[model samples]
Target: MIGKLSSKEGVVNVLVSWLPLEDNWYARILDENLTILSLYETGDILLANHIKLENFVIKNILKLSAIYCYCGNSLSTKAYGLAHDQIRKCLFDMNYDKSDIVFNTNSAQLCSECDANFDRVNLPEDFKKNLKKDLKKLKKDFFYRVYDFVQTKPKISIVIATIFALFINILSNYLYEIIMGRANLPIFLVSPFVVIWNYFT
Candidate 1:
């Protein structure tokens, strides 16, 4: 499905898709004119077919300024962090600044990079306002779901759980670097949940 937000300069098109076999939800950005701009995809997808990404980005470099990549969630964590980092670095190498890039925890969340500077960007004031409202609702819904799942958990338990999650996140990132042969920040570290869970199981 495609969702769009308009700005005075252009419209930002959010294209969302799901990979049933891999259980990955992917979102990409396109300009107001329906011209493809950002090409952020799942790490697994990029690794499997990087050449296409390379060519597409190269062709649209002029029109592409900012990008938002969705890192995997608890039920599934692949190489999204690694893949996003690589793509951003590649864009940087091609002359895009680090600030031009942004990331979201999942399809439900707004782009942290873009949200922080919403007023400064070309996006319409109404769209930006609505996005902020949507983000709040999404966070609230997510919190309620988590709270229900782990009801009556002690404060200390929450603390310990958080620490353990960080530990595993760091370790998993290290393992991904070693396995993927690229040293970069773990993609999901910025997210609330750090554990990579299995959806197929």
Candidate 2:
């Protein structure tokens, strides 16, 4: 199982685990001796794995200077499945301990004291509402940061396109001068007409 432990306020120790089961998964959080705890799970542990993979991909994309659409799309699916299986194996090895478990499936809830901590578990409507608010704030913050950066720098795409167009224009002009022997007409005049003719014919 994948586990992380941290201490808060020098008194409360938190352990989080993603545990694999014979046919399912478990996630538990516990204090020392697994006495005070929280657990979550469903028979289908694969859902948690899916979330983990999606989170990873989003983080990866955020770090990239440019996103390759095809590669990102292809890797996302594979990464999700692989993360699920790997987390399952990790949880299995941890023996589903409770004292230090944090994130896990929603199917089962057990504290370190072996008491049912999630017997009254239900989806909190307010949780989603709050989460949406936080997400919107985060999205706004990201866009604002990106806008600030763009304002301070030249756009890479525009710069690249301009250079490309200049190269093509120079090459075509050179070719025309070589073939036509510098006919007294302006290069721009001949170039546009040539482009139009090539497009239609």
Candidate 3:
């Protein structure tokens, strides 16, 4: 009934909001072209997860493509029975758990099985192929990308951080020597590791 608010006809309209739908699953397909997305949580739903609304919405649009292609414009819950049983990070995963949405939101695509199903869809030529390539756009922001890199490569991050600190410390000490015409730098200005080693000795 919420879809009735739109005055425009013959156009696909997807209205999204934080509405209390049944079970509050990630999104509900009201119609083939109209889907109402559920974002009913404050934290761990979007902002806390470092997910931008724009990227989230774009990802949902991709999901809808595969959904409608297989389901054939039906709004029935059973129409999506072909969804995968496990979370394969596919666009067709049955996300009974709301947290599972993060999987699709972060660099997910249609599984090979589901992509093969596109042959049955009456979509334009290469539509499904284009959608596959478009999945790269649904990535986490720069900060989260860097955070994930650090998480996966902690040793590399530590080494880089140590090198950066040493470079900055030496540059500061040299600048101080030139400005004050002094031959040496203060202990704290030299390097934290040097101070720690001297204290230990």
Candidate 4:
């Protein structure tokens, strides 16, 4: 059993299972209550694409009260498991004081609890589609955060300068034709005037 929900009546427990990928393991999220709020085993997509799995859980399962992660024998070691310290650090980063989670090895006795009757429950048709959209948004948000972090440094000025140079290149020909009225003015000479004009306007 895990912690109680905010309602004190609706108990939410997330059960995690590890899937063997090519090199790394993928995790699947399943609520013990047989809810349709589950994410697919994204393999290395989460870590490789820099998607924030913790944010996904927090946004999609805002009402979750607890999480129960069951790992196989391979991940039974203290340093490696579905709910290891590395994962727990991210999960507990928010206001998780009211909720709790437990991780245990998949021993013979634990197999009984791990066997969830997922066939009986039919997920909605749009469940996977919605999950895909949410995942794309998560990846986008992660990149935006990374960009925000890097933008505060002095190196970002070089990026802005490069973009400005490209913008000037794109408009150089047109500005030259308009300025000389014969489409024969040198772009190098007209570019500075265009920049000054646009800046003043």
Per TM-score, the best of the predicted structures is 3
Mind giving the per-residue lDDT tens digits that candidate 2 earns over 15-98? 333334333333222222121111335312323323332222222222110111112311122222212222231211233343
How many steric overlaps are in each model, in order? Answer: 1, 19, 0, 0
Report the backbone clash tally of model 4: 0
Give the best candidate by lDDT.
3
Q: Which digits, one per residue and each the tens of the lDDT, describe model 1 over residues 1-201?
A: 454534444544534343332222222222223422333343344334222333333223222223321111111122122222333222222222222232221112334443454344354337545543443332224554466446756676689789999999989888889679787555765343434333333
CA displacement after TM-score superposition, residue 199 of candidate 3 (Å): 57
**Which lDDT value does model 4 have at 163?**
96
Show where candidate 4 strays beyond 4 Å.
Answer: 1-84, 87-129, 138-149, 152-160, 169-173, 184-201
Q: What are the lDDT figures for the candidates, one per model? A: 0.37, 0.33, 0.70, 0.37
Better of 2 and 3 by TM-score: 3
Write down the lDDT that model 1 would get: 0.37
Q: Could you arrange the candidates by TM-score from highest to lowest?
A: 3, 4, 1, 2
Candidate 3 local lDDT, 112-157, one digit each (tens): 7777677766865687778878887778889898997899999999
Where does model 3 exceed 4 Å of error?
A: 1-10, 42-44, 71-79, 159-201
Q: Candidate 3: global Cα-lDDT? A: 0.70
Error of 2 at 183 (Å): 11
- What TM-score against the true fold does each predicted structure earn? 0.27, 0.18, 0.67, 0.29
Please identify model 1 stretches exceeding 4 Å from their true place.
Answer: 1-15, 20-25, 30-32, 35-116, 139-201
